[model samples]
Target: MTARRSMIRRAAAVAAAATAAVVLAACGGGNDSSAGHEGHGKSPSPSASAPASASASAKQGEHNAADVSFAKGMIPHHRQAVEMAELAETRAGSAEVKKLAAEIKKAQGPEIKTLSGWLTSWGEAVPTEEESGEHAGHSMSGMMTPEEMDKLQKSSGKAFDTAFLQMMVKHHEGAIEMAKTEQSNGAYRPARDMARAIITSQSAEIERMNKLFGKS
Candidate 1:
């Protein structure tokens, strides 16, 4: 009986050992499966995020030579328009002329800043006041000659009103042309949108100025 009991104890111990081995193997397999799932989850993170990063970079940097030209040309153009508008503040004879000049100044001043910012970001030169003055007499569409600008500056009352109206109408027409060119050729969305705005606003202002010509 003693030997049989001893044999039974040894058999039980062997069975327990086998059961423990089976349990350990199952736990290890579970751990391996969980680790595999974690690896799979992490694998796509970089690739998934890469496209979004690339797309954002592309959007921020997207621009062309036309966009550069548009900003560079329009900066000086807007500065001149603002200068003309400033002249109208004290020199204009008609309330309507003053109101129109104020509107022109309000609109073009921000646009000049925007254009200068773009040029600066693009590592291009912004036109200085002296540079703009130097090119004032150059044939850039409807740009007023030094003689014309001087005459407008010297005149006041009805003469100033008439000159401002006539010259502004012509200047607005030039701006429209430049804006149209940007709309046609620019790749930058903001610049193109600004160009469209310029075209619409200037066209309307041109019509208004034409109507005010003789009245002024």
Candidate 2:
């Protein structure tokens, strides 16, 4: 009887140890899965983050004098377009003309801000409202003179539609010229990208305006 009891006790102890080992293995598996999930949740380390940021800054600052000139010249050039577009709200006769004016104002307004921001970020001076003469005859393409702006501001109705389309077509043509130059000579990727966008959008607008002029 005593021998039998000893054997039974030994069996119980063995079973208990086996159970503990199985429990430990299950817990370990769960912990490993949790650790793997946690690793995926973390953000990229600073070493990786720094290089991406530095590369973008480098691209922005890598520009040549032509890039700087483009931004400076284009900012004011865009501002004049916006100014002309705003005049159409009160002066334009055709619904189509008004719509186009609004589109130009909407698009160019933000572009002006973007160009100014790039200039500031690149350690270049942002163009001022009164800086028309500041660039020493670099002459922004597509920009209206003060006299032309006054003339536009003074007109109304069908006369306004005719004048706006005529002037804007010429203006867009000039902008395309400048953008082409930037695409060729500009160094900054973002500036070059902006140039391409200008070329595309303005080209389309030019076509639309030409159609409108033909109908008029």
Candidate 3:
């Protein structure tokens, strides 16, 4: 859970700049881009909401199945990850935890917007559901539960750090799985590249997390 949140938050942080001008609703007859929703401070979108829309869009072009699935599946997955990263920043006592949280938030923010835009342009449902679990649980790569998140948020100091690394490692692995699935099954150029990037980067992070967790 922690890892997933971190990833999404990171996505947002990166895309923060690009997301300012959103043209939602125009995607598939949805509500239209409200620009972070009137005063609520741009709530983080779960992965479930964006995929359906993305899938519809991906189908239109030379884009392959992997691209659609990657966007559809990953958008909700990234939402959970961003949430987790925020929890860490607020609850964690360690500087490392804070820094990591900042990184996650930075990276995920824009990805969320980018994927949403993709889905909108594609004219799909956005892969989101009314209930959060629509994601089919963390069974997919880079996903975590609210309960698991509670565990991470409750820890502190060394324990918090350890749990964070362990959880993030698993989270990154999940992302890798999703990415691999994209690479094998997806067809879009940019989407495929993103998948490969996730594979290359998270693999290293996974190793680092392991070493950190193993430390006595």
For each candidate, give its TM-score against the true structure: 0.75, 0.70, 0.64
User: Candidate 3 at residue 148, lDDT?
Assistant: 74
The digit string of per-residue lDDT tens for model 3 on 113-148 reads 887777777676686643235344555665677677
Regions more than 4 Å wrong, model 2: 1-61, 132-138
TM-score of 3: 0.64
- Local distance difference test, candidate 3: 0.71
Candidate 3: segments with Cα more than 4 A from true spot = 1-61, 129-135
**Ranking according to lDDT, highest score first:** 1, 2, 3
User: What's the lDDT for residue 153 in model 1?
Assistant: 96
Predictions in order: lDDT = 0.90, 0.87, 0.71
Q: Can you write out model 2's per-residue Cα lDDT over 1-216, one digit (the tens) per residue? A: 999999999999999999999999999999998999889988878897898898888766588888898898888788778878999999999999999999999999999999999899889999778875434224766666777777888899998899899999988988889899999999988899999999999999999999998765
- Sequence-dependent TM-score of model 1: 0.75
Give me the displacement of residue 206 in model 2, in angstroms.
0.3
lDDT: the better of candidates 2 and 3: 2
Best-to-worst TM-score order: 1, 2, 3
By summed lDDT, which 10 consecutive residues of candidate 3 come out lowest?
23-32
